[model samples]
Target: MFLYMLIYLAYHGSRWIPRKQRLKFQIVNAVVITLVLVPQFYVIGRSKSSRYCKQPLLNNLSASIAFSFIASGFSVIFTLIEPIPQSLWASYHLFGLLSCGEGLCTTILTLTAKDCVKTTPELYYMSLFQTVASILSTGFFMVRGGLWLTKLNPGTDLSGNNESPAVPH
Candidate 1:
């Protein structure tokens, strides 16, 4: 991961940015990645260590609140960075990096939460549903954001025209 970041920055992000602004871009992006990763690392570690000792997060009110805050922070950080990348390359790379991180988060949840799912079948179904729904929504919003970045309206039909279809309702 560290090596990938070094190569990614040197070859991709910094190469396209102005020489004078390259350092700032790299630093800010590195910091952003770090900020996003720390909590994920914590969650992965906690999942491993808490297999037997910890209470179910869904069963505990305060713990659920704390988890909610962490989730919100994760979302808010992504939201804040959504418009920062000006170029298509940068935007796609940022999305790739974030999606890579999200892959780990999703993988860890699937692996570590199996025990809980065994005890509660609904948890499995709910997680599956949420995972699919969130992925779809995230992709959709990113596409819309990209359209906005390119000075296009997402509501318009992009099939070689600006006309939007009328809603049946």
Candidate 2:
């Protein structure tokens, strides 16, 4: 999930670079984004035949896959549509919210496990930490999205507009 978030950030942040260089970077971004999902698919496939497959773990994995798919779809669409900055910002926040759902499922799974014999201290700590991080990230993305929306009009074409709304000096 963190990897996906970083990729999303890089894909969006590429807009800050000069246009001539942006195309090459975006191509690379798309490749990397696709590569990142390979391991996840492998994990899901391996888990399918495993005797220890549990509901919470499966839920977490499925949510993560859904988030990845949605992010990938949006990234491709953004590249084709060249949406405004406000849309990009909103997409990132939406991704963050989806990530929170994955984190919550993981936390619940970790907490409600009926069998402690298979669980370890490290697993518990990791889930707890991730839940906290996801909550924090959700808040951060929401605030950042709101700020961007306020600063940039959603209807404006940022691709061609050179002048942004005036800021008080």
Instruction: Give all TM-scores, in the order shown.
Output: 0.32, 0.55
Worst 10 residues of 1 by lDDT: 53-62
Where in model 1 is the C-alpha error above 4 Å? 1-17, 47-137, 141-169
lDDT of 1 by residue, 28-134 (tens): 65565565445434443443433442224233222323343444343333333424345744554564465445534543564556666555444343444434544
Which has the greatest lDDT? Answer: 2
Q: Which runs of model 2 end up more than 4 angstroms from their true locations?
A: 1-4, 47-49, 85-95, 111-169
State the lDDT of candidate 2 residue by residue for 1-169, as single tens digits. Answer: 4533554576567777765667776787688667756655665565232335343554465566677677776665555445548877786667766666676677677667545225433333444455565666556666777778756765455454645577799
lDDT of 2 at 149: 74
lDDT of each: 0.45, 0.59
For model 2, where is the 10-residue window of minimal lDDT? Answer: 116-125
